[model samples]
Target chain A: MSTETKQKKMITDVFVEGARKGWNLGVNNIIPNVLMAFVIIHVLNITGLLALLGKLFAPIMAVFGLPGEAATVLMGSWLSMGGGVGVAVSLFNEGLLNGTHLAILAPAIYLMGSQIQYAGRLLGTADVNSRHYGILFAISILNALIAMLIMRIFV
Target chain B: MQEERKVGLVSYLALIFAIIFFSGLFAKAAGWLGVFDFTVLNGSFGKILGEGGKAFEFRGSGGSGAKDGFLFALTLVPTVMFALGVVNVVEYLGALEAARQLLTPLLRPILGIPGSAGLALIAALQSTDAGAGMTKLLYENGEIDDNERSVFAAFQFSAGGTITNFFSSGAALFTLANADGSLAVTTPMLIPLAVMFIMKVFGANVMRFYLKATSKR
Candidate 1:
C-alpha cells in the first residue's frame, strides 16, 4: 500500500512531505538547540566569561582572524551544528563577530561539527574498530583547521 | 534496498538545477532570472516599527535569552521549510541517482574505496545514519574491506549529513544580514560547501594514508 501510494505521489506532495520534515526539525531540533545556545551566550555575556574566553583564546583564534569568544562557537558546534550557528548568531548580534568572521567560521563549524554524536551514530553503527576512533577524531579536527585556513584566504 | 535504475537526462538536469538554485549566482540577476536563486526566493520578512519608532523585523533588536531565541527560531522555520521543499523536489527528480552514477567511477581514485560504496557515499551526504547503516551492510556483505570502511567512516564522521544539515542549519548563516540589511558572509554559498566537500575527501585520504603506513609497520 505504501509503495503504491508513493508511486502515485506528485512532486508537490514530495515537497510538502519534505517541508513537513523541515517543520518538525525546526520545532524539535533547531528551536531547542538554538534557544539553549542563545541562553548560554546570554549567560556567558553577563558573567563576563565570554570576555575572559575572548581574551584567553585571542592569540590562538587570531590565527583564524577570529576573536577569542569565537572559540565558544566552535565548542558549541562540536556539540551540535545548529547550536554552533546559534552561538555565532548571538555573538553577531552582540557585535563580537562580523560577517567576515561568520564566513571564516562557517565551514569550520560543520567540518568538525557534531563529532561527539557522530562517534556513536556513525562509528558505533558502522562497527569500525574502536582503536581507530582517536585517529578519526584527529583527522576531522585537522580537516576543520585546514578549512579555516582556506576560507581565510577567500573571505 | 535501492533498486538499480537507469540514470536519465532529467536526473542530470535536476542535479544542475539543484546546484544553480543554491549557488547564489543568480541571486542578483535581473527580473525573472532571479527566481532561480535560493536567497532571492527565500525573501525577507516585512519590517515593523519597534521602540522609538525604529524599524525592525519581528525578532526585534538587542534580544537575549529564551524569548529572543524563540523569535529568532520562528524566523528560521520558513527558510527551513522552503529549502527542504526544493531539496525534496530535486531529489525526487532523481538528482541523487545521477550523482551516484558520476561518483561511482571516481571512488577508487578519490577515497581508495570500490565503486560499490558509491551509493553509501551519496547517502552519507543526506543522512548520517542511513549512510552508516548502508556502509555496515556493504562491509558485512564483503563489498568493502576493513581499511576502506575505516576511511569511509572518516569521511562520514566529519561533517556527517553534509547536504541536508548544511542546507538546513547552515542556511541560517547564509541568511544573516547586516544592520543595513546587506547579506552577511560575502563568500558565495557554494564556496563553503565546496570547501567542506574537498575537506571531507581530504580527511578520508588522511585515514587512507594512516592505514597504509600502519599496515607496513
Candidate 2:
C-alpha cells in the first residue's frame, strides 16, 4: 500500500480503538446510575416514600414552580443529567406541561450531578481527604436552590 | 514515573476522540430508540416516602426490554467510567505533572488551587457526575490542600457538566429551530448563556465562602 494510504488506515485504526475504550468507560459509569434509578423507582413504588417525600417538599418545590412530584427528577438530575432529563420528560408528559414551563423549570433540572465530588474522587486516588467531596455537595445543592429561586421570579 | 506506565501523547488524543464519538453516538442512539420510554418500567420504588407520600412519583418508561434497557444503560454508563479510567491512566502516566508544572505559578496565585486540582476541574466541566468520582479520587490523594479542594469543588460545582448542554440542550435547540424552519441563532445563543449564568452565580459563592472558611480554619 502507498505510504499515504497506510497512514490513513493507521489513523482510522487508532480512532476506532480509542472509541472502543471510551465506550467501555461510559458504560461503566452508566450502569450504576441505571441500576440505582431502577432500585430507587422500585423502592419508591413499594414504600410510597417518594410520595411522602414529595408532599414534604411540595411547598419548597412550588417556590421554583415545580410540582411536589418534581423532587425525584431533581434528585435524579443531581447524580446524573440523563436521569434528571428522563424524569423531566416524564413529568412533562404526565402533566401535559407546556414548553415554557419546562423551559423555566429546566435550570434546576440541569443543575445537580455534583461534579465537584467526581473531581475529588479522581484526585483522591493520589491521597485521602480531597476535602472537595463534602464541599461539592454543598455547592451543588446550594446552586440548585439559588438558581431555582431566581428562575422562578421570571416564570 | 515507571517507564512501563508511561502513556504517549497519542494515547491521550486517541482517548479524547473516542470519548466524543461514543458519547455522541450512543446517547443519540438511545434517545432515538426510546430506550428510556418510561411506559414499560414504573416508579423508582414501589411505594412513597417522606411527607405527602402519595404526591411524589418517580416516572419510568420502557421496560427491561433487553435491547432498550441495555442500550440506554450502556449509553449512560460508559460516559462516566471511560472518562474516569482515561483520567486515571493519564495521571498514572504522569502526564499531569508536566502540564501542572507549566501552570503552577499561575494556578497557585490566581485560582489558589494546586496544579493537580485543575485536571479534575476541567474533567468535571466536561461531565459532572464523572467529575465527582474523579474529585473523590483527588480528595483521597492528599495532593490537594483543604483550601485548594474547597476552591476546586466550587469551580466544578459552578461550571461542570457542560456535556449535558452540548447534547441535550443542543438537540433541543436544533429541534426548536427546525420547528420554526428558520436559520435563527436565538435558541442556540440563549441556552448556553442561561447555563453559564447559572454556573457563574453558584461558582462565585462557592469559592468565596470556601476561601473565607479556610482562612478561619
Candidate 3:
C-alpha cells in the first residue's frame, strides 16, 4: 500500500478505537442497572409491592376510567411497554379489565411509557445523561397525563 | 469550500416520507389479495379516506384491538433487547472508539463535543436515560466538561431516539398513508412527527447557540 493510504487507514483505526472505548464506558455503567431493574421488577411482583403500589395509584387512575388495579400496568409501562402489557395481560386474565380498558390504557402507555431508568439507557446510546433526560421525562409525563385526561373526556 | 456529503436534514425528512409511501403501497398491494385487513379503531381506510374524518365510537372487535396492541408491544421488545446485545458486542470490539476518533475532531469544531462523548451521543439516539447515565460516567471521570455535556444533552433531546420514533410515529405515518390505498400522504399522525422533528432541530440549535455564547464569556 502507498504511504498516504496507509496513513489514512491508521487514522480511521484510531477513531474506531476511540468510539469503542466510549461505547464500553456507556455499557459498563448501564449493564449492572439493567440487571438490577429486572430483578427489582420480578421481586416487586412476588413480594406484592406491585399490589401495594396499585392501591396507591388507584384513585388517580379512575380519572381516566382505568380500574384501581390498573396502576400495576401503569407501573409496568413505566418499565417498558412489554412490562406494562404484562400487567395488562394479568389484569385481563383475572377478569378485572376488559379489552376497552386496555385500549384506553394504550395511548398513555405509549406516551410516558419507559420509566427514567430505561429511558436513560436509550438516551445513553447518544451520550446523554440524567439531568437533561429528566427534563424530557417531565415533559413526557405531563403529555401523558393531559392526554389521558382528554381521552377520559372524549372517549 | 467543498460541500459535505453527510445526509441533509431534508434527506432525513424525505426518508420518513418515503418509508410511509412505500409501506402504504405495499399494504394496498396486499389488500388486492383479500388477505390482510387494516383496521384501526372506529374507522378503516375506506371511511377515513372517503370522509376525511376520525371515528367517534368504537367500531372494531375488542379482542382484535388488544391482540394488535399486544403484538405491537411484542415487536418493540425484541428490537430493544437486540439493541442491548449489539451495543455490548460493538463495545467489546471497540467500534465506538473508531467512531469517536473519526467524529470527535469534527464534532469538537462543529458541535463542540469532546471525542470521548461520541458513544454516549450515539446511545442517546436509542434511549435518553441510559445515555445520561453514560454521560455521567464521562463527567465523573473528567473526560467531558459540563458545557460539553449540556450541549450533548440538548442535541440528544432534539434528534436522538430514532428507534422509538420509527415504530411509534413512523408506524402511524405508514398506517395513515396506507389507509387510502395510494398514499393520500396526509394525516393527523403527521402533525406529531413533524412537531418532534422540528423540536429536535430547533432544540439542538438553541442549545448550541447558548453554549457557544457562554464559552466566549
Candidate 4:
C-alpha cells in the first residue's frame, strides 16, 4: 500500500492487524513449541535423564556460568527459539536454573537459534552453496557462545 | 519495485518510539514515562490464592506435563498480542523504511554487501522468508555476487526473523520473575538485542573470511 493510503488507515486497525498476526504466531508456533519443550523436559525429569545430561554437560556449561542442564536450552533453541525459551523457563521453574542463567542464555538462544529450520528456510532459499553451510552453522554457534560470555558479565 | 521509498521524519520518530517501547528502559519509571515501556504496558496477570494461602498467577506452581504447558502458553498469549500490536503500529509509520534508509549506507562497510541489500537485510530481521526471497532476487539479478550472498546469508541465518521471533517468543523470558517477584533479567532488553546484532555482523565477517580463504585455494 502507498504511504498515503497507509496514513489514511486507522491506527487501531493497524494495531489489530499486528495483534492478529501475533495471535496466529502464538497459536501456531509459540504454543506448540513450548508445549513440546515442556513435555520433553517432563519426560527427561521423570526418567532421570535430565540429571544425567546435567552431569555430562556441567563442566562445559560452566564456562558460560550456566548449569549443565542449561545445555538443554541451547539444544532446544537450536531446533526452535520458542522451544529453547520454554526449556529455560522449565528449568527455572524447577529451581535448576536461576535468573542469572536465564539472562545469560537469553541472547545466546537466538544467536544460534533455529539453525535446523533456517538451513532450509534461509540458506536454501538464498541459494547459498551447500558447501558453505558448515561454516555458516559454525559461525552462528560461535556467535552464541560469545554472546553468552558477554551476557554473563552483565547479569 | 526496488525503488527507495522516501523516509520522512515521522518514520524516524516511529523507529525511535519502537526502540524505547521495547527497550525496557522505562520499565520501572514512575508516572507517564512508564507507558513507553513494553513490559510496563504489557502488565502482569492478577494473582490468585493457591495452596498454603500463597498467591500465584493462573498457571500456579508445581504443575506438570502437557496440562501445565498449555496454561503456561495461555498466559503468554496477551503479551504476544500486545507486543505485535505495538510493532504493527511502528511498522505502519514506516519505522522499517527509516531503518532501511539509515542502514543502507553502512551495509558496504559492515556486511560487505551493496546498499541494495539493505532492504533485504531489514526484511530478514522481520521475516526470514521475505528476506531470503529478496536476497535470492538480489543474487539472480546480479546485484550481488556469490561470495557476498554467502556473507549475507550468514547474517540472516544466525538470527533469522530476529525482531518478530524475539518479541513473540523471546519476550517470555523478559517476563520471568524471581520467587520474590522481582524481574528475572535486570539487564535492559536493548542490551541483548544489541549483542545479537553485533554478533550477526561478526558471524557474517567470519563467513566472508572463510569464503575468501577457501576461494584462494
Candidate 5:
C-alpha cells in the first residue's frame, strides 16, 4: 500500500471510532438527564413553585442586582447546570428575565455550579484538605461576584 | 472492640455543601424560586409580566412567550448532544494529549500551570467530574506535582464544564435576545469565560503561594 493510502486509512479509522464512541456516550449519558431536567423545570414554573422560591430569595438576590426570581436559577445551578438552564429558560419564557439577567447569572452559575460533588472529590484525590475545598468554593463565588461587577461596569 | 473514628471538619463542611445543594432544588418549597408567586400574578406584577394583552401562561400561544421559550430550549438538545458527542470523539481519539503542546502558549504564561494540565482542562470543559477524575489520575501517576495539582483543581472548580454550560445554557442569552431583542450570546459568553479564566489563574497562583508559605509538602 502507498504511504498516502496508509495515512488516509489511519485518519478515517480514528474519526470513525471517535464518532461512534461519542454518539454512544452522548445518547446514554446526556439525553435522559437533560430531558428529565426540562420536564421537572416546566412543572416547577407552571405550578408557580419557582416564583414562590424567588420571593423568599428576593432580598439576598436584590443585593446582587438581579430580580428576586433569579434566585431560582442560581439555586438550580448549585444542584446542576442543567437545572439552572431549565429554570432560566422557564423564567425567560415567563418574561421574568432579560439578556442582561442571563448574562450575569450565566457566569455566576458556571463558577459555583459543580462544587458539591466534583470539586471536593477532585481535591481529595490530590490530597488537598477539605478546608481548601471550602476555600476554593469561596473563591468560585468570589469569582462570580467579580464577574457580576464586570457585567455591571463593562458588559 | 470497635475503633471509633471521629467526624472531622471536612465532613461537616461537606455536609453543609450537600445541604445547600439539595436545598437549591426545593427553593420553591421554601418559596424562593419566585419572590411573590411564580404562578399567574394579579394587578401590577401581572401587568408588568403580562404586558400588551399578553398573559404569561404556560404553553401560551404566540407573542415570544413561555411556550416558545420551552421549545427554544428544547432546540438545544440536539446541538448539545451533538457537540458533546464530538467532544467524546475528540477525547477518545486522544486529541487532548496531542493538543497539550498546542495549548502551552496560553496555559503556561496565562494560567501558570504546565502545558500538560491542558488535558485536564479540556476534559473539564465537558464535565466537572470527568475533569476531576482525570486530575486525580494524573496526580496518582505522579504526572504533576503537589502545587500543580492544587492549581489544576482550583481551575477545574471555577470554569469547569464551561463549553457544556455555554452550548446548553449560556445560549439562554440567544433565546432571551430573540425574544426581546437584547444581548447576543456568543460574545458576552466569551468575555465571561475570559474573566473566569483569569480568575482561575489568580486562584491557582494564590493556592500556589499558600502552599509555598505553609510548606506543607
Candidate 6:
C-alpha cells in the first residue's frame, strides 16, 4: 500500500483503539464515583445535614468572607465540586450569594472542591496508600483557604 | 565502557528529540492550539472552547426548582465519567507514558516531581479524580516515594484539576449570562483560576523542598 493509505489506516486505528479503551475506563473506574458522589450529595441535601453543618460553620465561613449559609456549599464541595456548585446555585437563588460573593467563593470552591471524598475514594483506588489520605485531605482544605484569602484580598 | 558511553549519549539525545516532537503532537491532539475553535459536532454534543463562546448559565435546575442536588448531579456525574473515560483510554493505551515524558519539563522544574509524575498531573489537569487515580497507581507501582506522593497530591489538590473545571462548571467562570441575554466574561472572573494555579504550584514545591530537607536531616 502507498504511504498515504498507511497513514489513513493508522489514524482510524488509533481512533478506534482510543474509543474502546476510554469506554472501558469509564465503565470500570469513573462511573462508580459518579454514582457514589451523586448519592452522597443527594442524601446530604435530603437529610438536611448540609444546612445544619452550614449553620455550625457559619462563623468560620464569615472569616472566609462568606455567609454562614454558604457552609452547605463547602460541605457539598467536600463530596465533589459538582455538589458544591450545585449548592452554590441554590445559595445564589436564596440571595445568600451576590456577584462579588460568588466571584470570591468560586476560586476556592474550584480549588478544593471534592477534597474529602476524592481523597477517600480515588487516592486509595489509585493505590497511593492509605496513610497519606489524611495529609492530602488537609492540603485540600489548606489550598482552599489560601485561594479564598487571595480572593478576599484581590478579586 | 567506551561503547556503552556512545550508546547512552545517542539514546539521551534521541529521547530529548522524541519528547519535543511528542509534546507538540499531544498539545495539538488536546486542542490547546486553538485549531478546534470553530469545530462543532452535533447539538448537545458540546462545542469546542471558542465555539459557543458564552452560553454558560449557572442556574441549573438545582437552583431554579426542586432545590435538591439532583439536577447538578446529572450534569456533574456524566462529565466526570466522560473526562475520566477519555483520558483513561489514552492512559490505558500507555500513551500517557509519552505525555508524561513530554510534560516532565513543566512539572519537574516547578513541582520537583519526577518525569513520570507528569502522567498523573496531566490527568489531574483534565480530571482531578483521574489525576488522583493516576497518582495512586504510581504509589501502588512503587513509582513515587512518600515525600513525592505528598507533594504531588498537594499540587493536584491546589490546582484541583483545572481543565476539568474548564469543561464543567468552570466554563461558566469564563463567561456568565446576564439578565439582558448578553454574555459577561471579565478578567476578574478568571483571577481565581490563575491564583489557584500559582498557589497549588507554590504549595507543592513548598511541600517538596521542605520534605526533601527534613528527609535529608
TM score of chain A per candidate: 0.92, 0.58, 0.58, 0.95, 0.70, 0.61
lDDT of 3 at B135: 73
TM-score of 2: 0.49
Candidate with best DockQ: 1
Where in model 3 is the C-alpha error above 4 Å?
A: A1-56, A119-137, A150-155, B1-217
C-alpha lDDT of all candidate models, in order: 0.90, 0.48, 0.47, 0.88, 0.57, 0.55
Query: Chain B TM per candidate, please?
Result: 0.96, 0.42, 0.47, 0.95, 0.52, 0.50
Local error of candidate 6 at A138, Å?
1.1
Better of 2 and 3 by lDDT: 2
Better of 1 and 4 by DockQ: 1
A37-78 in candidate 6: lDDT tens per residue? 445545655788656766888889888788876766666676
Say which candidate scores most in lDDT. 1
Q: Give model 6's docking category.
A: acceptable
Output the lDDT of residue A48, model 2: 82
Candidate 5 lDDT over residue span B1-217, tens digit each: 1111233454344334322322223323453433322110111111124657654423334524334544454444444443334333444334444444446567877666666666677767666667777777767788777667776777777767776555454533443334333333323335565666667677666666776787856
The lDDT ranking, best first, is 1, 4, 5, 6, 2, 3
- In TM-score terms, candidate 3 sits at 0.39
What is the DockQ ranking, best to worst?
A: 1, 4, 6, 2, 5, 3
Q: Model 3 over residues B22-46: C-alpha lDDT tens digits?
A: 2322343443432221222112322
| lDDT per residue (tens digit) for residues B1-217 in model 1 | 7655567898899999999988889988999999999999999999998789889988888777989988888888888888889999998888998999999999999999999998899899999999999999999999999899999999998899999998788877888888978887777778899999999999999999999999998
Off by over 4 Å in 1: A1-7, B51-53
1 or 2: which has the higher DockQ?
Answer: 1
